[model samples]
Target: MKKSYCPIDTFINVVKGKRKATIILHLFQGDKRYNELAKLLPDISERMLTKQLKELEEDGIIDRKAYPEVPPRVEYSLTDLGKEIHPYLKGMFRGGILFEKRIDESL
Candidate 1:
């Protein structure tokens, strides 16, 4: 199948969005519950977080599992592919930090 523009850019777009990568980083530790993620990412709204998580799961970057119980339970974890792309995400974060450092130094 033919792809539009740079495939690499498209791949990045899939996982890149406001607070999305940070969510992924948190998941890198292990599977996390809905409340756990919300607690970890307090800056993000519940609606936005829900949307981003659904998108990530759709993109195969993460998996959502629910267990039948009284209170209900759901957990999110990085799919194998998410782990594979995490190194690249780490590099991106490092580069961003460098850029911020450079700007601060110049100022």
Candidate 2:
């Protein structure tokens, strides 16, 4: 893979946007339908969600599959590369929880 000018920037580039990390974290469970993701991330606008999903897909972080039917069924799941990042994200989440607890105790 070609390296970005800055490695940290490259990481940020793929995981940029308000809900990108959350989206990835959610996909950690398993494949999810479009509506299911939307419901899970209710604060994000439809346009924003679509844009983020597209960007993640382009970055090779996630896979999007569409089924042919009366109403198209679409599902999103992490690609292999995406799954590699899951451990780091999970660690970060756990750290955040620990930090929050520390802060609460300090207060």
Candidate 3:
């Protein structure tokens, strides 16, 4: 992760990539194979999903395991660091809902 003057900036730096936070949130529920993640995040292009997963792995937020098989088996799970950040991310999720509700009400 990139060093920053503020802790929040450092946190943001790790999760700034496309769908990074969403991927973490999904993984927080349980370990998931690559195809399952792809299905969960249909809006993201395959290339972008691959890129984000790689970045999250590099950041030590997720663990990637591969198994030797005919088709290849790979699973992704959150690391301790990733689990540690879940509460904070969940708070952000709740905050987003609040804002979205306000926006809907305003319309």
C-alpha RMSD of each candidate structure in angstroms: 2.0, 2.2, 0.8
Model 3, span 1-94: residue lDDT tens: 7899999999989987788999999999999999999999999999999999999999999999999998999999999999999999899899
Task: After the best TM-score superposition of candidate 2, give how far the Cα of residue 45 lies from its true spot, in angstroms.
Answer: 0.7
Question: What is the lDDT for 25 in model 2?
Answer: 98
TM-score of predicted structure 1: 0.91
lDDT of each: 0.90, 0.91, 0.95
- The top-ranked prediction according to TM-score is 3
After the best TM-score superposition of candidate 1, give how far the Cα of residue 83 lies from its true spot, in angstroms: 0.9
The local lDDT score (0 to 100) that residue 45 gets in candidate 2 is 96
Model 1, 78-104: lDDT tens digits are: 999899989988998999999999999
Winning model by lDDT:
3
lDDT for 76 (candidate 3): 100
Off by over 4 Å in 1: 1-3
Report the alpha-carbon TM-score of model 3 versus the true structure: 0.96
lDDT of 2 by residue, 58-96 (tens): 889999999998689999999999999998788778998
